[model samples]
Target: NTTAAAVAMLRDIPVHMSYSIAVIDRQGNYATVYVNPDRPAEVVERRVSTNHQHGVEWAWHAETTKSVEREAAVEKLLLASASIKDVLSGFQRPPAYQIQYGHDCGTLYTAVYRPLDASVELVWPGSLWRQSCADFQDEVRTIRFNDGGSGGLAPTFKEGAVSS
Candidate 1:
């Protein structure tokens, strides 16, 4: 969600611009993304776990509850914060926004994008956070979630390609 929006800003494009984004889990196992409704002509190569085409469908499951809770928490934080940094900072727990579900699932990293400066801040699994700036056109930034350590770097990708 926020990451996708940040990516849109980084690319200097409208959020509804026709593009497909994929987000893989920490283990590089599972992945998900919200399909772009504005671009019905675009084809998604992967299966989308949660669909945002119509509206949020709350199925009976713990995973769904966690997802809904995180969405609500992020919305509340977004409204209260004065800046993107504030919003990112607020994500550090008491509310426990970071997920760590042993071997099954967990949050690998958190990121914040500052479109005005073309900069992004990445928070790794060990609570280590770093910031970097780049030319969104020629170079793209990415975060890799691994089983041990997680990190990010700005890599050269084909123009208009989305990384998650």
Candidate 2:
């Protein structure tokens, strides 16, 4: 049910280029929703019924070696979201942030959102779809980073920031 909402959000977003899109639930589980057939097939989704090895992994961690101008663009874009504002309000108190990477012409912002807990949550959303999501799973994998106190999505937090 939640996966369907994520997919709907992807389709509603307008993009200039073809790109694939995927979304991870609060539990770090991912499901591919958009796949650009124009691009080469990368992440192929499998009908796994209690099977753990059917889906392709996502590039949960990444960096553009060529310094794409998209990084700055993403930061600026995310600043517009309510989530960023909430984090910036108390970034130094606890839950230190380590920016990973982002994409788009100032459209996508990807990074970790940590609260009182040491664990972190990967939050990214862009204005453009880079390509169909056909190869996304193969190209990206859910990244697990050890930081903060416990891991969780902070903006939509609970129990005064986090819980074990």
TM-score of each: 0.44, 0.25
Any runs in candidate 2 off by more than 4 Å, and if so which?
Answer: 27-29, 35-164
1-164 in candidate 2: lDDT tens per residue? 35557666665666554445545555544665444434332343521111012232333322321122223333444466467556443332112223222332121123442222323433432111122223322233333232233332222112122222
The superposed Cα distance between candidate 2 and the true structure at residue 33, in angstroms, equals 3.1
lDDT of each: 0.44, 0.35
What tens-digit string does per-residue lDDT give for candidate 1 at 1-164? Answer: 34445334434434553234554332333223344535333323342222132245445433533555555676677778788567766665423243333343455456654445555565643444345455433444454433322222211122233444
TM-score of 2: 0.25
Instruction: Mark the regions of model 1 whose C-alpha exceeds 4 Å error after superposition.
Output: 1-33, 36-65, 94-96, 125-164
* Model 1 CA lDDT for position 132: 48
lDDT of 2: 0.35
